[model samples]
Every structure is written in C-alpha cells, then in structure tokens.
Target: MTNFLPMTKDDMSKRGWDQLDFLFVSGDAYVDHPSFGPAIICRLLEKSGYKVGIIAQPDWRSTNDFKRLGKPKLGILVSAGNLDSMLNKYTAAKKYRSTDNYSPGGQAGLRPERATIVYCNRIREIWKHTPLIIGGIEGSLRRFAHYDYWSDSVRRSILVDSRADLLIYGMGEKQIKEVAAQLSAGISIENIRDIAGTCYRTETLEHLWDYIEIPSYQDVVNSKKDFANAFKFQYLEQDPIRGKTLAQGHGEQFVVQNQPAMPLTTPEMDEIYDLPYQRTYHPSYTAAGGIPAIQEVKFSIVSHRGCYGSCSFCALYAHQGRIIQARSTESILREAQEIVKMPDFKGYIHDVGGPTANFRQPACEHQMDRGTCRGKQCLFPNACKSLDTSHTEYLQLLREIRKIPGVKKVFVRSGLRYDYLMAANDMEFLRELCEHHVSGQLKVAPEHISPKVTKLMGKAGKETYLKFKKAYEKVNKDLGKEQYLVPYFMSSHPGSGLKEAIEMAEFLRDTGYNPEQVQDFIPTPGSLSTCMYYTGINPLTEEKVYVAKTPHDKRLQRALLQYRNPKNYELVREALVKAGRQDLIGYEAKCLIRPPRNKQNIAVSQPENWNKKRRLAPSRTQHSKTKQTRKI
Candidate 1:
C-alpha cells in the first residue's frame, strides 16, 4: 500500500494485525518524511516484515496518551525527535524558545523537557517489562555520563537516567535492524548488549571483554582533569573500525557502549533512500499548519551522510562518525524525478547536499580499514597528507542534477567547507558554483578571524578564509555576477574575550559586512567546545582557556558583530572602551561608533535651545512644530 503506516487503532485494524511488532514514539509531530529519523527507522522496520506504528508527541503528563497505540508485541522505540530536545527548547542562556520547528504549526513547548527520559519512563510505568529502546540526537549524544550544560553538572549516563533497556547511539539503521532481529528471535534485552552502536547498563564486568574503562561518574564530576582525560579517550575511540568497547562505572553499575557501527556502502545508502516514503507530513496535520521542519528538506536531496570537518562545536563526530557515506548519483537523480512529479513542485530544487555539501568521500583510503586517525583531524591544522581533494564526481553530479527536466536551479544550501574547496584548487567547480548555485549570496562560516579563537574552535586560520574570499570574488568577476560571500561568525566562544571580539569587529569593518544575526556559544552536549565551557580546559590539549561567562560580557561581544546598528551604539562603545580600544571611539573613519553622541557636539549641531527646556506634554500643534523643527 502507498499509504502511511498505522498510526491509530482503527488504522491498525485495517492492517489486519492484532498488535504491532514495534511502536515508535517520537517527540515531534508525525511526519513521514525521510529526513525525520523516526520515519526512516520505522519505515526500515516495516520493509523488514515487521509491523510498526507511530505515536508521535503523545501527551506525557500521564501514561494514558501513550496507551493510545496500545502495547507492542515486541518492543517500544523512542526518539526525542530530530534535534536534541534541550537544544530545541532552550537557548544558550537556558531560556525557553518561542517556536519549535518540529511541532505542528511551529508551536513551542508541545513536548516535555528531557523528552527521551520522560517518554521512556512513561512506557516503563505502563508496560512494566516491555523493552524500551532510546535513540535520537538527545539519547545518542548523552549516552555516556558526559556533562549536561542545562543541568550545569555531570549527570549519569542516559541509560541510567531513562531506565531504557537498550540505548542505540549514533545513526541507528544497522543497530535497529540488529535489535529487531534479536527481539524477534526471543532474545532478552539484557543478553543483547554485545551489538555495536548500542549501550546498556550492567552490574558485572564479565559481559564486557577487551574494553576501555572511562573515569567513574563520581570521579569525573569531582575532577576536571579526569573528565578531560576521559573525553579525550572517548573521542579517539569513536572510529567504527578501530574503536573499542567503552565502559563507564556509575557507582554499583556500569554503562557499556560498544564500538560504533560500520559506515554504509554506496549501494546500502542507495537502498535506504529508495525505500517508500510518503515524503510529506501526515495529512492529519494540515489544519495545524503542517509540520514546519519538512518545508526545508521536502524537495531537497541528501546525497551523503557524516562529515569529515569535525568542528569543535559540532556533535557529528560522536553521532555520525567521521567517515563520509554517500548515495549514488543514480539514486539522487531518481529522487529528483520524484520531486518533479509533485503537484506543488516549483522549478527550484532547494538543496542538493548533505552535512557539508562539498565532502562526498572519505578523507583518505586508510580511513575505511584503519579508521580516522585517533588524535589528528582531516581538515584542521592544515589538510592531512593523504586527504582526497577531488571535486570531479561532485561537480559532475551537480551538473547532472541541473540537466533533469523541470529543474530550473539546484542550490547547495549546506555550509561549504571553504578550506576543503581551497584544497581542491579546481576552477571548473568554483566557476559552475559561482554561476549556477549561488543565489546572490553564499553563506560560509569562518567563525572568527582571530587565530587564537579559530584554533580553539577547530577552524582554519584567517589566512585560509582570506584566500577563499579573494578566489570567490575573482570567479564572480569573471562570470559577470554580483554574488557575495556572507561569512558566519560566533561570539563568546571559549578563547574569545573582549580583545578577540574587537579584533573580529575590525575585520568586519574592513570587509564592509554587518551581520544581521549572531550566534552566542551555547555549550550543548557531546561537543569539545562544551567541555571547555564547563571545565575551563580544552579536553584535547588540557590547556586552561578563556570563557566569557557573564551576561554583560556576552552581550558586549554580540554587539560588536553589529556595531553599525544605532540601537547597539552604547554597547559597542562600551566594548571598545573596555577592550582598551578607546582610541577607536572618535570620528575617525576606522572608529566603530561615534563617541556616544556627546552632548556638547549635539548642542553645537542642533538649534540654540534644543534641550534647554524639556517638555513632558505638548499640544498637537506644538508636537507637529517640534517634529518639523527637529527634522530641519
């Protein structure tokens, strides 16, 4: 059948099944699109001859709403939606957000806080002995007893907190299939702990063989050095091929995480995307303005998975691993053909890329067998010697996508790895990208121009960004195009102080671009940057770093990015003065802002008695005359 899987009891009856084999509960509203992780996992289960039903965003106030789908015959699958629930609900300041893109109608607060723990606990309350499996960004990233930025302390593993029988970390396709097969064969959840990409709590160490034991939960919480050492080891062992089983003790019990699952091959990636997907939100949500997250990716194509960039603030390494697994060109073209047939299809295909648009293959040949280097990065600290810098295949694929009928333009909306592109030195791809892909503006993240800050953020030096900017301008000039590079910068990241923020502001002043929006570093879980923010030490190097923790400093740093805005005039001047740059506050061309509108200067420029007498109330005629006089 081409319809969505059973979502309610009536739909289950129509399927002629007494009970579903698996019940998937998600924090997001039901959307059967491929980009949503719940939809992908549920559909993959159905394709394997298992009956799966979805209960999305169920009322978590009690177990009554969870019983709507009834108990499953085999197990319950729970995901805290696509993005991490904490990240979706709170800003860096730990303030509640006003809009949730994953909810119906983009509503906020549709799901509870710490959604995975809430959903899993609710299932346990009713089902008693049923297998509760937790997988998603929230669960995967917090699988270990790492830091919790929201809680502001080191919490135990989610496997301990959620009371889940099994925790599937990372991309869970391979792990999900394995769990389904074992559960179908009547295996106990406790006995199924040996599978890769899974975590479970155990009382004894007998089940774990040849594993590395991370620091005990109590020790990590008490000692920053111990936590940094533990994280460094965990980061190194993330490679699927060379990774070892990792175990961490939580008082009397232990949370054991197995080696990461292997990366999918090209054919496997193609098969995963070729599966039947409704490719849109369930029609039941039409009245609630439909699911807001689907609009961005409904017409887009995901050509690959995983990223090699490994930025410090990003969690892709811990979740998707470092290797790149891509779908075939034929599969991409097939998806494009399907998009052309949609009734609402416009001539534009929004994006034809993945995590990083330009990264289409592994960094080197050794990565597949030996795994990513333990202590080294692929693109940072200069590209590795064995890195593959070819864009020939990706260039050809984009060209083919453009040739498809009904496709007027194909844009690469994902952030391009500028350092990677610079490594390629391929003018043809750059030429095609400048002429065809860019829509008057291309957004690239250089983060900050300060060498001290960029190094701490795991980004290339300012020299690399400058080289790319020059090259981009040359290409546009040659093509007779007016496209511009809108660079992304962050404020208040570790290693960024008032001095570094002012340095970035000077770079912005020179470049003639004012950022409309700025990102303040929010210390989310499973990131190196968050570790530094919490412990004041870089985990990789064990060096004490500067972190802007006060709200006053953070606001001052953010205001420097948009120093031209008159609303931020006082804040910008304050930052400049505080950073020992008081010389930059005068009427010089290089000054960030005029010296706070001096009253003496205003008196000289204004009419004789402009502020001599302040009027609290005025007649309509007087108000009109005052407004006209001020304008003159």
Candidate 2:
C-alpha cells in the first residue's frame, strides 16, 4: 500500500496499471534514496507522468525474473548500480570482494561481473526487440573504448559491447528526462542521438557534426601509444560548454558521444533532491540486513555535485564533471528536517558534503561560461590565481545545519581537500573546523609525500602538506583541542616506484605516525591514472611513466608504504635492496627496519635478477606530442 515504486507485478496491479512506462533494471537493490542513481531516474520519470518500476538485481541467468513486470511502454533503462559492476565485485588485488554494500544482506555475487551486458542479454532473450538503454557510473565511465582492469585489455564502448540503443554518460537527471520525452514522442531510440550526455552506435559518421574522431578499438589494441592518444581526445571533450561531439570507431560502426549535459542550476538541483523519496531500502529488504550502502547516505545529505580537485586517480570529475552545482541552503535544510523525522533518527547527523566537501561553488566564474580550462588543473602546479578560495558559504551552511532542532552533533566526514583549504589564505575556516566539525581526528588525503609521484597525481607537493600540518597543529593548539590529522596515502600509482615508496616510508618514520589503513591504487575505468596504468604513458603529457604491473612489483610498493608492519618486514627489505638503497637495512636510528636477528632472519621470495628487473622498470621521459588531454 506504500507509495514505493512498483518492484512487483502486484504493486503494479495495486497502482491499477497493467503495464508500466519504464521498467528500470539495476544491479543494486532497490533503495529509494536520492543518492542512488536508479531511484532519482525512476522518480524523475514518474514525475513526468510515466509509471516506473524497478527490477533490482534480477536473476540474469534466465528471463523469468526480468519478465516479472513485463516490458516497459517506452524502454528498459539499465544501470549497474551506482558503482561499476566490475569494481563492485572485485578488489584492487583482482580478488573477490568480501561483501557488496549495494546488495541485500550485503551479499556478493548477487550481481554478475558485467551486469549491464549480462542483464541486457538475458532480457533480449525475452523482449528481443525492446529498446534497451544503459547508464550509471559503470556505463557512463566505460561509455568509450576503455581499459578494463579486470580483463586487463582494451574493451569496446559499453554502448557497442552491450548493444544498448543508447548510453547516458554523466549525472543523468537532465539526460534521462530528455531521453524519456523523446521516446514518449515516438522517436526511435536509434534516432535519439542528439541528446547531450548520451552515446550511441552508428554504421557511419554521416549523421554526426562538430565531432572529433578518435582512433578505433582496433587501433588502440594494436598500439599502446594510440590507446593513450585516443583516451586523451575523450578526456578533453567532456565539458558541456566547450566540449564537442567525439566519435570512436568500433569494427565497421562508430560510437558517438555527444557533448556533456550542462551542469544543473541551483534550483534544478533543489528540484531533484526535493523529489518524494522513501529515503531507505525497500521494505522487503528490511528482513535481510537491508542494503548496506544506504546506511552511509540515509542520514548524510549531498550538498553539491561535481568536484574540481582533479586528483588523477579519481573518476569523480569524469562522471560528475568539474563544475560544481550545489543545492540552496534552504533545500539542504529541508532535507535535514526530513532526516530528523525518521523513526530511527539519532541526534547525530553523520556527514554533510559531496565529492569534495569544501567545494560548494564553482572554482571561478569562467567555469559556468567557458567550461574548466582544458589542459590546466585548478589546484595542481599551485592553485590557479583565478580560483575561488573563500569557504564563507560552505562554512555558514554547516553552521546552520548543526543548529537544526533535533540535531545534536553534525560531522563533516566527507574529507575536505587540505590544499583547497590552504589556498584560501585565511584560518577562519580551519579554526572553525578544528573547534567544531572534527570528531577528534580529521582525515585528509595528501596521497603521497614524494614530489615526483605527487606531481604526477596532480596533487599538491609535500611542502603544502607540511604547511597544512603545521597550521592544523597550531589551530588545535589554540583551541586547546587534542584533534589529530589522519592523512591518506596511496601506493603503486602510475608514477610511483620503490624509490618514491621509500620516500613515503621515511616521511611516516619522521612523523611517527603508523597508518592502519593503506590504499593501494586500483586502476578502474574513466580515470586519468587508469589511462596511465593501461598505456604506461601520461595521456596529458604523452610522457612515458613508470608503472608497476607485476604483482611482486606492486607488493613491494605497498609493503614500503606500511613498512612498520612486521608482516611487511621481508618485503620491505627486498624492496630496499632492489632499489639499491641497502643502507636502509641497517640497525641505525634512521633505518626503516632494524637488522633481523639470526632467528628472525627470513628470505623473501623475489625475482632471481632483482637488480636487473628494477633497472628494467620504465622511467619517466619527456613526450609532449599529445598534450591535449584532460587535466581535471
């Protein structure tokens, strides 16, 4: 009897409908929260006077479950949940993940490896000629020819691979609306090629205009350089304002991607967030452990979308765009009131931020008009002179959220960029953060302490991190608070070698900080770092970058990052000797590890020609020919 979207045929019958307008198939469980893409898209379609139902995590092995709601009136919308299906199922080490947060009861293997392709294939067995549209982080990021970390090879665009009629690439509120309207107006899915933020396959490029053609899938598979160059073109043309149509060839056909959808205005953002949502997992899931992913966002409110802090390893900018679109304070406050009204409401409002918490507005005025600078970064190589450094509005919004009637402790757990905060040149926000927001420790991502690696990561150098550390200590000192800074670090990135990893270990030694959590870099699709990982060349620079592809090579770097762990002792020693830094193996006070005693001495499994292998590793080189890649 509840107003949840029809997940069952009976629910459709309850709504007095024989067939629905859209039957959305998602890789994740049915969670009616706005943070979930499937929820927003379905709710938006419903708002447009279309009946929408969701078939979450359908048994892809057969067509029976997919037929539960029969075929949709317009088309079947598909998504591999909020996360890519491959990423959701695998870990950085290419091992089975222990659990899937998006699944009911936090189960794994409920969804297939490539859910969109698998689901569509199964549905095709039943509804052979029905329109199939795919979109989500997985579909969007892999909308072009991409390197699949799991498969360890170049794969065709999802639009081509899944044989979907269309692919929505970015945040889909706008694109979905346009697509649904066009479909309702009796436009063939094949003819709906002009919508922004969408991709489609064509037999020829005759219908396309204002487009740049990248190398074909065959071209990339044959040459690494061509792969890097193709990614560069896809990266540069992602902006809605300045971006142009891009087409990549697949066999005899071409997959064309239209310009990105424009960033949603504040009122537009408010409208999407203000939509009626049940704000939790479907009732049937309650008997199980419920959807694990909802717990993170059920109480947390997303204040904005998109991030300008373009760390190379992050895919946010690729999916969300660099231009920030934030909800009005009143809109956010209304969501907070709704949170307070929940039956299980606690005094604590967990987190209030987006991809980057401190970035509530666009970096500068130019982004809204001209789009973000193509080949330049906003915060890397020092914050741009035109960057907006003030945090007044964000700070004020936080103040207002905490003062809400039932809220007791409001936290900002979505980590803020320390570099962005430092660029402000004002301590007011920092002081306020230390005094109020932090829960004894504030986690920041300096990522690495080595200059070479950090530079390649598009991150601030060690100097900036040190300056921020000193200032943070002073702020906490002035406030008489014992708050600490927990910095996040990544190992085995594109530019990192044993030498850079050692530099990080030494920094940890000097700081006397031992991190319990270490993030080893994972090369997922649609990220600059992933491109570098696949090609061993920086797409933005066309420069040869050192990449550790071997499992042993990666282990060495990860071991060096967590050098203090006793389990890493042998691996750390192996890495140090391989790097020709055997002096670090001594019992000196500055040494990474004390020399092993006779009883403790153990041999680590390493290549017979360790020195030769280390010497053979790729090193950085200058190649400026392909300099037109995406920086953010």
Model 2 TM-score relative to the real fold: 0.94
Q: How close is candidate 1 to the true structure, as a TM-score?
A: 0.94
Worst 10 residues of 1 by lDDT: 623-632
lDDT of 2 by residue, 137-227 (tens): 9998998889999999999888887888999988899999999899999998878988999998999998776789999899999999999
- lDDT (Cα, tens digit) per residue for candidate 1, span 1-632: 32898888888888787899999999998888778899889989999999999999999999998998788999999999988888889887889999988998999998999999999898999998999999999999998878887878998888899999999998899999999999999998878987899999999888667899999898899998888888888888998999999888999999989999999899988978998998999888899999888888888999999998988988889998899999999999999999999999988898888889999988899999899988899889899889999999999999999999899999888879999999888888999999999877777889898999999888998899999999999999999987777677899999999999999988877766667667888888888888888888998988999999888899999999878778888898888877789987755556777555456656124334433322222221221221110000
Clashing pairs in 2: none
Model 2 lDDT at residue 289: 85
TM-scores, all candidates, are 0.94, 0.94
Q: How accurate is candidate 2 locally (lDDT)?
A: 0.87
Clash tally for model 2: 0
In model 1, where do residues sit more than 4 Å from their true spots?
Answer: 599-632
Candidate models: Cα lDDT each: 0.87, 0.87
